[model samples]
Structures are given as structure tokens and as C-alpha cells.
Target chain A: MTSADQVPFDDRGLAYGDGVFETVLLRDGVPLLWPYHRARLLRGCRVLGLEPPDDAALAATWQAPASGLEVLKIILTRGSGGRGYALPESPAPRLLSRRTPFAPAASRWQGVDVCLCTLRLARQPALAGIKHLNRLENVLARQEWQRADIAEGLLADSDGNLVEATAMNVFWLADGVFRTPPLDACGVAGTLRAALLEQGVVGEAPLSVETLLDSELIEQLFVGNSVQGVWPVNTLTTPDGEPLRRFSPTSASPLQAAAHRLLGYVPLSGPSLSGEKR
Target chain B: MTSADQVPFDDRGLAYGDGVFETVLLRDGVPLLWPYHRARLLRGCRVLGLEPPDDAALAATWQAPASGLEVLKIILTRGSGGRGYALPESPAPRLLSRRTPFAPAASRWQGVDVCLCTLRLARQPALAGIKHLNRLENVLARQEWQRADIAEGLLADSDGNLVEATAMNVFWLADGVFRTPPLDACGVAGTLRAALLEQGVVGEAPLSVETLLDSELIEQLFVGNSVQGVWPVNTLTTPDGEPLRRFSPTSASPLQAAAHRLLGYVPLSGPSLSGEKR
Candidate 1:
């Protein structure tokens, strides 16, 4: 928050939002799941025309860092390009490492109530899946809800295909199969989502909003990000505040317990809300 | 460009590309088409949920002391909000006024060569026309060509709709009618494009790439922005460098003359390349 941490006026990340970033959760001074994050950051660099980072330099930087339950972040920018959108011939990509307290709302750990955002994510294959700096869509989606009880916003594409929660990957259980929307056209392929999928804990399904509204087939809903691991969803509502579905935390849900065990974490839980119980 | 001119590291504009900007072409120390650019900037503010700028303060600031034939830019951002995408409860919007030298590549003023960009503009109706900071698509498209000869890159939507050049609005004299793409789904509605349209010098048309590629019907091509007023396109090529069409600059083209007269500028001409003689 100090003035010393400011970026230059011509910084491309500021002017054109030309950059990529990674949010790493630190536990005992070690960045959790760093390999996956590093890989994604590197891929973002190549795709955005920024020179890839040096692994040795990055490893030394990551290892040499200091204390507390802080959230560690790395931002890579194609430096300043003034007002233009074109990349400079010799771009000096700025590699910034910043540390901030990992103090997200405590309520986030105890499940969340999400509303379907009116603003749908644009299908951009070129920018999809990478943690790039252009995140106005998330901001717009999050802006839709202001109540403390509503923790996150769920987004879909223009075609009504389910995308993700504002900052987390979303999944639902339907007929005992964990169904998560494919993010090839849009949405971030979140690290936690990747880990769960790689561990054979979840499967991809093309779930549209209409399909998700069918409460009969769906069993459970959960959303997750690295910062919060995974949290069960308590309810889903339409934009006009109509409750489409309500989910209660249950130890009996095999996927819920399985996800926690596989990720070596506990699923976030809150008091059950009213809905047609399974 | 200096250390003093830098922005905060946590600037929502930098962290999330949560900002909007306007470029005003300055001639003889006065910004050309200020009203139009100012209108667009205010509209961007309303759309992005930032407080509207004080008109009196803005007018006073604009009338304050300044010099040079430079490009005047105004950047409005909802300050820094740390790592989150949510707007701060009490947002402090930063208004930046900067002047950069008006020295674009000389080749830009003359009839320029363009090629189809491999990247497609993702159709986000939420962000179609207004120039927000999330411009990775334009950066990626402009990166498609490194040749000094290629002045700009033409972009299309996922459905083969011709959007616009990477940095300018485009219009073509098709079948004796001035036709330009309707920017409903994507593309920045450049200030010059608006002026020309408002003046009845051009008409909106839903142009697809196939329509533009049909060279027989189109008589002339022009691309423009506030920084560089309208300039004709001399050649067009596919992304893979196969020649799609070659346009000739002719004094005989009435619409070309009309655009120049309407904009109060002369059409830039370079040594004619191999094309039909005028």
C-alpha cells in the first residue's frame, strides 16, 4: 500500500493491462502448489510476448522470501509501452514479487451463496485459462452482489454455458459424476481445478445454465481457488433474487470427502439452507 | 515516462485492467474533437461504475496551460483495490492527464498495408465499443506482424465478422456506399469513426471478412483514429501473407475525396505500388 510499491505511468500493465499474474498461497514460508503456478505463468509469458523467466532466478527469488501467513504474488508485465497496444521490439518484462496478508473473509471458509451474474464472460480462447491481468469481467460479476452473506458470483458465457465463480472453478455432482464446465473458450483453468481433475476426482461436462437449473439431476455444487482450496455452495440464485437451488453440506457426499482427502484439505461448510433435499 | 509519473502497484487499473482512457489529437496546441472524446470517456465511466468526472473541473483542467502538437490522454481508474476484483466500497477514482509527443511512424499517415490477424476479437457485448484497458486482443493482433511495411492488422470476430484494424476504425467504399462494421459485439468505436458517421459521411454495415475479401465491389479502404486521421489502405493480405487484394489510390474515387473533405484533412499518398492505374 506504500507509494514505493507503485508502477510507472507507462507500465503496459497499467496502460493497456498487458501482463499476467499468479496468486500463491504460502504456508510455513513455502508456496503451495508452486510448480503448477510457475508453469501457468511461463505459458502466459510466451502467449503475451513477454520473455520467459529464468528458472534458477525464479527459484532463488521464491526461496529467499520472508515471513507470516502472507499471500505471495508474482506479476510479469511487458513493461511500459505508453498509450499504444503494440509490443516494443526489445521489451523488458518486469518481474514483480509482492507479499500481502492472506486475510480473505473468514466467512469464505464456511461455504458461499452465489448469484448468476448478468455479465457473461466473453469467449476469448486466446486469453482463456492464463492468469492474465485483464480481469474486468470478474470485477463486473463481483459487483452484482454486495451483501456479506453472498460471497461470490457465478458467471456463464454469452452462449449460456456455465463458466466459473468470480475467482474459483465451479463443479457440481450429477448422478454421482462430478461435472465441471470446460473452460477452453473462456474462464481460467484454475490450479486447484487442474489438481483435482488430474487426481481423477472430477470430470468435465458441458453444463449450461438451463441444464444446471434442472435441480432433479444435480446432486451438489462446489467452487474453489488456491487461496480457499474448495468450498461447498449453499445456494444458487438467479439475477432477480429467485433461489434456483439450495445445497446443504453433507459428510455423506463421497466427492466432497474425496476432494478434501485428495487435496489434503477440508471442505468449507456452512449451516444448511432450505431446499429439496436429496 | 519518469519515476514521478508512476501509478500505485495495487492500482485496479494495473492489477485488473479496471480503467478507461481517451486519446485527443492536439493540433496547434488545441485538442481536436474534444467533445466527442470527452463524451465517450464519460460513457465509459458510467459503464464501468466509476463516478462521472466533474464537467466544470474537467473543462477548467482542459483549458489550463499546455503546449506542443502532442497527443493528450486522460486515464481514469478506480485506484488500487489490492488483489481482489471487487470495487472498494468508497472508490477513489484517479484522473490522469498526460501528453505524449505526436510522432507516430511516418508510414502510418500514408496509405498503409494491412493483413488479416490470426486472433479473433471475442464478442463481449458488455465491452464492445468503449475502450477499456483490457486490450490483450489488440496487443496479440498487432504482434502478428513485425514487418515495418505492415502498418496495421485487421481483426475479425469468431464468426468471421470483420471488426476493425488493431488500432483504428475501418471503412470501405463498397458499391458506392461508405460501409463500416457495426460494433455491437466487439471493436472500439473510434472517435473519428463516430464523427464521420454522425456527419453522414459513412454508414454502418455488418461487414464480414468474406464481404471485405470480395474485392470487386469495394472501391476504397480507409482506417482512422483520433491520433491518425483517416488514411487509405493500399494493400491487404491474409494472415499467412497471401495477397487478398490490392487497392489503388485514385483521385477519381469520390468517397475518398469526401472523407478527406469531411474530416478537413488531405488523403496521404505514397509512391504507388503495382496496382490498377487511377
Candidate 2:
């Protein structure tokens, strides 16, 4: 889209990353987990001090994809015309959407190799959890690896606490309990992560890289998000290509299966592919 | 301007804040401190892994204001079409500019009131010092106060180290030495701050709000940015409207005068109004 056809140059979202976004998965032209997405978008608006559009207005902005699995990315900005950091009195919030085709990889569903990123997420309790646009950290972390085999890179906070993957929330089975890092410090509280937490499939905990690398303590690991379903982590490697931990990719773990079911993801070929049942 | 007339909705600047910007002061259509602004923009591009536009291409984007003291804000984004955090291999950067009328407040030059923000800046060395688009911290801090008299707000890092003002760099005279906080951890490394440091007029040091509030140690305080020049902070107040420290606003300090001289600011009335001497 041309500049005139899209966001204005003076937009606060373009100027200061003063906005929040939601990436929703579309199944046969219907948005999956839309209620969760809407809730998170409203929460983000509250955190950023922007007056959110009402449910009717918000729902009007969504457009059904042509067909099949697609990604519907919605961005809500504080709108244009703010004096530097000072916000305008009555901000005219703008909602923008983009739809892109999504093709899920079967290998990712079975298992995928991940790497440890060198970049650490800054602890900003105010902006944490909400998927605001200040995502240079994630961009930098994602740039750490270029190998096709490395599906994702995990990030940690400045305090060395494992936060999440570059684009997804991470969870691991420890002592027969599925736990993920708390987003109280820093990390995007993924919609998928929240759904799993609500379903009592996972719990929050302080996860450390050192502790997670010990396979004996935590063997089952996976990463997930709203648009992309859960991907079981088969191998974990450092930025320098040193192997940290490895898991058997014999089959999708019970947690992964549960997440896939919740996400409405249908495995290409597997006995435990029960997402269609939902 | 319409969205098509300005930044595209898909522009990475709006999508992920994957960009850097510079605000320059203009006098009679001539940009002040153009070199410093250019250098910092280039530095920001490097930090964000964005390919810097050529000098000619960069200069082509600047549109001289109608006349007088106007603000020219130039934003260079990593263009559009990046899959989430993953950048496009051959990225196309976009240069956008906005010109606005700037009226200097005579009282701000004399002395202005500032507040201690409850919102703390997140320490991210990777994004620190560069005037990148991820400025939600500044936006949040600026929202902490609404009084017209309060011209700015001072921010501290999570570690309680005084970083900078909402939109300006702060400096104080402590132990007969002029010092500002180092931008190694957080805060924007402003062009004026760099110019002052380069001219040997100011030095860098870690400052604490507690230490700064102690009048005996730090009596002279000021805040500055490229567009507004130097503003002598007359009083510091808490968010609850409680006075923390008050300084004599009889006249501008020598440091402020020096900074004004470098910034090409002509005061309304003052004995040491020597910005025109240059």
C-alpha cells in the first residue's frame, strides 16, 4: 500500500512504537481464538492509555480471509497528532489489518531445533506481556540465527531468566508439571499461552537457562503462539552451534497434542492428531 | 495527509517500530546541527541493522520549512514486508519527514518546572543511545503529568539511576562538574547532549534522583533537546504535587548559556544571551 493508502507518516505508531497488535489464525475464513485476541487487544489498549474501540467497532475491522489457514494481523495505534511523547487529549485511535497466507510445516509439529539468542529482553513491567510494537529486541534475537534447521531462538531477560522464544511463548515439563516463564518481568503473554494456562495445561514459573538445559530435570519442551501452533523443541543449541540439550522426536508430546487441539491445528499424519475433533 | 500520502499501513515503522528518527531545529529554512542529526540517524540504523540511505538520498528527503524556527522530524524505517521479526534479506528503507511550527517558550529558556516520573525506563543497551522508534517509555513517562507548568518529567532506570527527561537530556552541576547520565544502559543519546559533550561543556556520570534532590550537592539543573535548546529546571516536584527541590530562577546558568550558544538559540532578554555570537 502507498503511504497515502496506509498509515500516515505522522502516526504515533510509526513514530514511537506507541501501539499494540494481535496476530490471529484464520481457519476456513473464521478467526480462531478471536475472543482471546479481543481481550488481549483491549488489555493492551488499557496499558497504553488508549481509548479502545467498542466491541462492535473492533469486530467491524476484521475481514475474513479468502479461504484456508491465514494470518490476520491487527494493529491498533494511538493515532496521529501527538506532541512528541505527550499524548493528545482525545486520541483518534486507528485500527489497521493485514491478511497473509500461512502454510504450517509438518516438521515443526513433530519437533524443531531451537537456538539460544545472545540478546536479552529488557525488564519493563509496564510494557511486559502486552504485545506492544516495541519489538526491536525480538527482531534482533530473530536475526541471531539464519540456519533453516534452527526454527526459533529463545530469549532471556537481563536477569538471565529464560523468558520466551523470539516469536512464541515457551513451556517445558519439569517434575511432571508443564511450566512457562512468568511474563511479570518481560515477555509477550501469547494468546496460546494464556489459553493453555486457562485450560490448566500449563503453569507459570521462574525458568532459568541453566536449569532448562539439564535434560534430566526437564526433557519435554515446546514453543507456541496464536497464529502458529505448538512446536516441540527437539534440540536446543547455543548461538555458536554448541548443543545444549536434545529431546527425542519420536512423537508429539501430550502437552503439544493438547495445545494443537486447543489451537485447532490438524497434524498432517499422526495417530494423536485429535485437533479436528474439537 | 491521508495514509497514502504518508506512511503505508504496512510500513515497518508502524508495524514493529523498526526505524530510527531525528528531530532537527530549523532557522529561516536552514536546519541547525544537521551533521549531528545525520550522524545519530546513521548510528541508529547501524544499531537496528538497517541499511543506511545514501547521503544524497537522505538529504533529498528534507523539506525546508516555510520560515522561522520550525521542527523537522525525519523518520527512516526498514520499509515494509518483513515476516514478523525476521527481516527481508534485501530490505528497502523508507524516509519520511514532518515539518511543524515551533514556538519557543520564553519562560522555558529562563526556567521551567519538571517532575519525577513514576514510570522507569527499561535498561536495554542494544536500543539505548539511539533515537529509535521504540519510545513507549518516554510516552508513558510523559503521560505521568498533565500540568501546563510542568514542561518536562525526569525518568530513572529500573536500577534507580536518573537517565533523561521525557524528551530531553538532563544535566546538573555536582562538585563543580557538569555531568549527564551515560546512555550506555538506557535513555536517548540526544544530538544536543552529544554536542555538549563534544565541546567539553558537559561530562557523563551516573546520577541518582535522591542525590539530585539534595540541594546542597546539586543546585543547578537543566534539560535540553535539539529542537527546544536548553531549559533551566527551576523546580522539581513529585507526581503528587509535592515539591522535592527548588532552584533559583533569577537567570540562566553559565552552562545553560553555553548550551544555548551551541544550539543557536537567541534568548528573549538576558545579560548573557550570546547564541548570536556564533
Measured against the true structure, the TM-scores of the candidates, in listed sequence, are 0.90, 0.94
For model 1, residues A123-180, the per-residue Cα lDDT tens digits are 9898888989999888878878777666677899989999999888898888878878
lDDT of 2 by residue, B1-278 (tens): 11123677678888888989899888777787889999999899888889887887666555543667788778888887777789987788888776777876655676778899999899999888999999998898888888887889999999999999989999988777889999999989998899889989899989887788874878688888887778887789986667888976535567777767776775345646523232
The candidate 2 chain A region of ten consecutive residues with least summed lDDT is: A269-278
In model 1, where do residues sit more than 4 Å from their true spots?
A1-4, A56-68, A103-110, A251-278, B1-4, B56-68, B103-110, B251-278
Candidate 1 chain B — worst ten consecutive residues by lDDT sum?
B269-278
Model 2 off-target regions past 4 Å? Answer: A1-5, A63-66, A267-278, B1-5, B63-66, B267-278
Q: lDDT for each of the candidates?
A: 0.75, 0.81
Question: Chain A TM-score for model 2, please?
Answer: 0.92
What's the chain B TM-score of candidate 2?
0.91
Q: In candidate 1, what are the lDDT values of residues B1-278, reduced to their tens digit? A: 11125677777888888989888776656767778888888888877888767876455435655665577777778886633887886777777777766754434445677888989999988878998999899888887876767777899999999899999998888767887899989999988788778978789988778878885787788777777666678889865566888876743344445554544455434345223232
Clashing pairs in 2: A3-B3, A3-B4, A4-B3, A4-B4, A4-B5, A5-B3, A5-B4, A7-B9, A9-B7
Clashing pairs in 1: none
